[model samples]
Target: MDNLSNYFGQNINQKRIVVTGGTTGIGKAIAKLLVSLGGRVFVFGRDENDLNGALEVIKAKSFSGEILGISADITQKDDIDLIWNKVDNAFGGIDILVNNAALPARGIIEGNYEDWKYILETNVLGYIAFAKEAVNRMKVQKSGHIINIGSMSAEVKEKTGVIYVSTKTAIRGFSTALRKEINPLGIKVSHIEPGAVTSDMQEDSKEVQKEKIVSMEMLEAEDIAMSVLFCLSQPKRCDVVSMQIRPHLQII
Candidate 1:
């Protein structure tokens, strides 16, 4: 895709952006692209090493906007509070929030109750809590955008992927209802559902993922990042509410 900030003649310079799960995969790509487009971004992640890695890359990039990394687990309320406190001190206020933190899950047939709880806490509860924070702040500001990263499994509903699929489906509903409730308040909410992306979240081994990538059976992280930028670049009068992006060859 073309340079997003310049593509539609949009001016996002200095825009304060908060991205969850931004130390890897699709979130990292979004952070990199946002910085390249001159948007000040604060990316949150649970791992210190990954946060440092992402920060290094962001700093290495030559762009007008800068990036910061925060070490915090999205599932923790204390961490969430600290994230916002840091954001307030660093950016004064937020203009955009991207809820992208999620964990992959597999079959419930084995009764992996622990894994299921963790996934729900991270994917479902985490998103809702963080979004509630952004909505409260955005409501006061009277203008803001919250973008939720969902998955195509929300609709596809694969048998073995019940836990992961259920969370994405919940996100779809949350996005739609939140948009209706907040649109009149001047806040925009959107959901981006992607199909078969090559990421660490995949259940397959790295070797298999590599094969899929080589065969062009999956979408790159940057592809989803561009779609995010596309939604952000739209005119104020337009809201690209729900977008489902997939590689052309992806069967789903």
Candidate 2:
């Protein structure tokens, strides 16, 4: 008669989650889906207008779950502090943290020092900082999940976007090591690496993205969101360490 014995495993209802970069693209898709499934979702992005708009859209379809959003830059420590303060006030405690905020990068030689610095702060430091905050609270609770959105470019190592590839590779290493360090505390860490997802980061237009999806050259943002759901829905005894998802025809 135990609900946890169900084949689908844990229920998402009422779980408090924090999703960074949730204003658009993959993060937004994830926020929407998690809210629909009855998880209280707190999302944040750098743009105020976009954050407000996304909150509206997410709230429109939300039935039982709650959705809140804020305008903050992940790269700034003060902003990150403010975000956690708001989260603590809103949800009391967090059950999940989705580190999805990141900037698209240019090749190593294509940008100036400032540009490179900005990307590194936003993409790498931001993730670690947020995870630290989540870990502090989760450690006390002794139960939580951290889901990092990585990219297949980590392995592909394509020459076009060296900086991005490097950041993703770091994420790959971070996720693995973190899981080893924290799993004994009853916390789960999962890394999801996706290939060629259609999002605001892509140069393709919506029409082009749809065409590419049909051709099996691109995947929808929602596809990655579903993978996250799969990881979260698993039994407490099981941990989904890492997952790599790609389009059927995507080659490197």
lDDT (0 to 1) per candidate: 0.87, 0.91
Which window of ten consecutive residues has the lowest lDDT sum in model 1? Answer: 4-13
Candidate 1 deviant stretches above 4 angstroms:
1-11, 205-207
Model 1 lDDT, full chain set:
0.87
TM per candidate: 0.94, 0.96
- Tens digits of per-residue lDDT for model 2 on 1-252? 456434333557889999999999999999998888788999999999999999999888746789998899998888999999999999998999999999999697899889988998988888899888999999999999999999999999999999998899999999999998988888999999999999988988999999999999999999999999989988898889999999999987
Candidate 1's TM-score: 0.94
TM-score of model number 2:
0.96
lDDT of 2 at 126: 87
lDDT of 2 at 169: 92
